[model samples]
Target: MTNHTPPIIGLAGGIGSGKSTITKCFNNLGVQSVDADDVARLVVQPNSDCLNKIYQRYGEDILMNDGSLDRRSLRTIIFNRPEERTWLEALTHPAIKEEITSQLSKLTSKYALLVHPLLFETHQNAICQLVVAIDVPKEIQIQRVISRDNTDQESVEKIISTQLSNSERIHRANLILENTGNIDEMNAKVFKLHQNILELISC
Candidate 1:
């Protein structure tokens, strides 16, 4: 890699919209990636400071019998109540941001992808040189989530309702990838974008 700073590309999409699928495409092309969701999960591991704070606030019921967080219960709480979501974000977003920054700094790839569902929501998009929004129809998103996660439609809809609308995400992004359920097509699109990113960065 050149001494020039590697460009950070933020990948944004709704739940089940296949952000990870495209991130994996970039990974296959030799780019490194940092996922905010993965970072969030890491920060809340059992015995971690974040977990301790959460337990303090919400009490032992928020934990599983194994002592890990009861993520499903917490998800239900936050999605149903806006104030709870705000409180949770205030507690976790900063730590997630710090971890993401540190992870990005250590990447040696020509370009890096930061995959975040809340890229625009949490203002994390500001750290990215560009953002790619994966565009999938709402029905497709709901279907995919139900099929892949075995989740109910109501829960999926509730999650989707919390996120930026398709138009809003597109408005905030530099590029858009329409995911129509064809893996090969998506791969081709990502590969082209990868090459384009490399060329642009090399300049």
Candidate 2:
């Protein structure tokens, strides 16, 4: 890595808004990205301290037969109980943040993409030089999440309800990418935005 740290560009979007797809497009253009969701999973690997604490709190029922966290079960629990969600966030956020920082520092790209679903909600936008918000219709988001996760409409809608609305996210973002089209179109949008980002930061 160079002595001068590359600017971090944050990617923000609601569930199933195609953040991962966009990240892949940036990766194809040689931009390295640190995904908070990936970091969150790493912090809770079977024998890790975070996982151990979670097991102690939620008991063995939360673990799969293979000993990994049963994410779907835990997701149901947290979504139904707001207090439990808060407790889980308190336990996990700092570790996630630390790992995100460590991973971001190792990147040698012109700009690092910090892919986070709750970029603004978690105040992670503060660390970013710019933020790109992925905008999709509410119905599309619901349908995509349900189809992708094999979850029900109510569950998908509940998750979306917890996130900032598309308008709010767009208002807060430095750039917006609407994802109502097919993958090829989305890829083109991402490539165009990637070049725009390079130009913005260069100036």
On TM-score, the leading prediction is: 2
The residue-by-residue lDDT of candidate 1 on 1-203, one tens digit each, is: 23443688899999989988888888998999999989999999999888999899899889999999999989988998899989998999989998988888888888889999989999989877888898889999999899998889999999999899988999989888899958899889999888777776677
> lDDT of each prediction vs. the true structure?
0.89, 0.92
User: Relative to the unseen true structure, what is the C-alpha lDDT of residue 56 in candidate 1, on a scale of 0 to 100?
Assistant: 94
Q: Model 2, clash count? A: 0
lDDT of 2 by residue, 49-101 (tens): 99999899999889999999999989999999999989999999999988998
> Using lDDT as the measure, which candidate wins?
2
Model 1, runs deviating above 4 Å: 1-5
TM-score of each: 0.94, 0.96
Stretches off by above 4 angstroms in model 2 are 1-3
Could you report the Cα RMSD, in angstroms, for every candidate shown? Answer: 2.1, 1.4
Error of 1 at 120 (Å): 0.7
Clashes of each: 0, 0
